[model samples]
Target: MSIAISTALQSSFADAVTRTREALAGQGFGVLTEIDMKATLKAKLDQDMENYLILGACNPPLAHRAVDIDRQIGLLLPCNVVVRTDPDDDTRVLVEAMNPQLLVQVTGDPALQEVADEVTAKLRAAIQALGPTSG
Candidate 1:
């Protein structure tokens, strides 16, 4: 199975977050929501956890174009990216997204597939510019 692009980096938790948001925006994506996992877990379970943030990002034009081709593509809308702390207390972040090719299989729409492929590469470039290589 092909896992999503994940990576570790040496940066402050806040810096990682800011950089991620900036990079995503720079690449034409806008952050739709920010989920603070650590705060949520602590508030609900009274458990202390490392810093973790979830970012819901979307590119309006591309997304609209994709949905035009395959209305069901909404299932894959708003790509998710995460920022979390490592064991050593350093910050790391990862972006988990469905493979665009898989979306092609589901939608069976060539144009929609093209959009997914381009978005995937754009997201990859955004993450790589911010941290360690993801293999």
Candidate 2:
């Protein structure tokens, strides 16, 4: 199965990040943490790159359900959503999220399928709400 669900937005990187957060929030997911990859790389290694950010998003109810089924699931909790400019085309911004189904697939646990399915749907909706996407 595909590992990520993503969309391309015709907006500046900063605008895309804001819209991505709003879209995820509309789907009942909240940003629990954020990492500014561009700044980190520049500061630590004096490297330069396109704007990039990772938002740790979580739906508390869904997260709680998954953890109840498998304590180790926290390792994958707060699904990561990345907002970055396309390296090949700086004019385009990409918003991508981890496919929630991976949790069930990796664990090989049928019980977690239900929660994964729910999260997958919500994540899909969040990506769709952003704008047009390509497979």
Candidate 3:
């Protein structure tokens, strides 16, 4: 089962980044953190690397309920979305979510899986929307 869904865009990195932000915001998530992997590597390791940005997005109400059911589940909240170049030399943006089903195993809370699946769908939709600027 694929936990992530991705689409390659013909547009430049900046355009894709802008669309990614908009798509996520439309789905009730706000970017809590943005890590520029390329810039971080160059600054710390002195290596020029391809552009990679990590968007840590979160939806508040769902998270509050999920954590109330199981405190340790916070480790998985605010799912990760990665936008970067793949190894094949093709620039691709990837959004990976914590599998909704897996939450049931870890915490034994089926209610949380429902919430996770909803976010997963939105994340996939956002990735799809970034694919050509068309709808």
Could you list the CA RMSD of all candidates, in the order they appear?
2.4, 0.8, 3.3
> Comparing 1 and 2 by lDDT, which wins?
2
Itemize residue pairs with steric clashes in candidate 1.
Answer: none
Q: How far is 114's C-alpha from truth in model 2 (Å)?
A: 0.5
The worst-scoring run of ten residues by lDDT in candidate 2 lies at: 126-135
- Candidate 2 TM-score versus the reference: 0.97
Q: lDDT per residue, candidate 3, 10-94, as tens digits?
A: 5567877887788888878788988999999999999887778888888787778778878888887666777676545555544
* Highest lDDT scorer: 2
By summed lDDT, the worst window of 10 consecutive residues in model 3 runs over 92-101
What TM-score, over all chains together, does every model reach? 0.83, 0.97, 0.81
Winner of 1 and 2 under TM-score: 2
- Rank list by lDDT: 2, 1, 3
Provide the overall lDDT of each model, using Cα atoms, as 2-decimal numbers: 0.75, 0.93, 0.71
Encode model 1's per-residue lDDT on 1-135: one tens digit a residue: 344656676777788788888888888999998899899999999988788788888989888888888788888777788778884644444444444566676667777767878887878788787867564
* Candidate 3 deviant stretches above 4 angstroms: 90-102, 105-108, 132-135
In model 2, what are the clashing residue pairs, if there are any? none
* lDDT (Cα, 0-100) at 14 in candidate 1: 84
Candidate 1 root-mean-square deviation in Å: 2.4
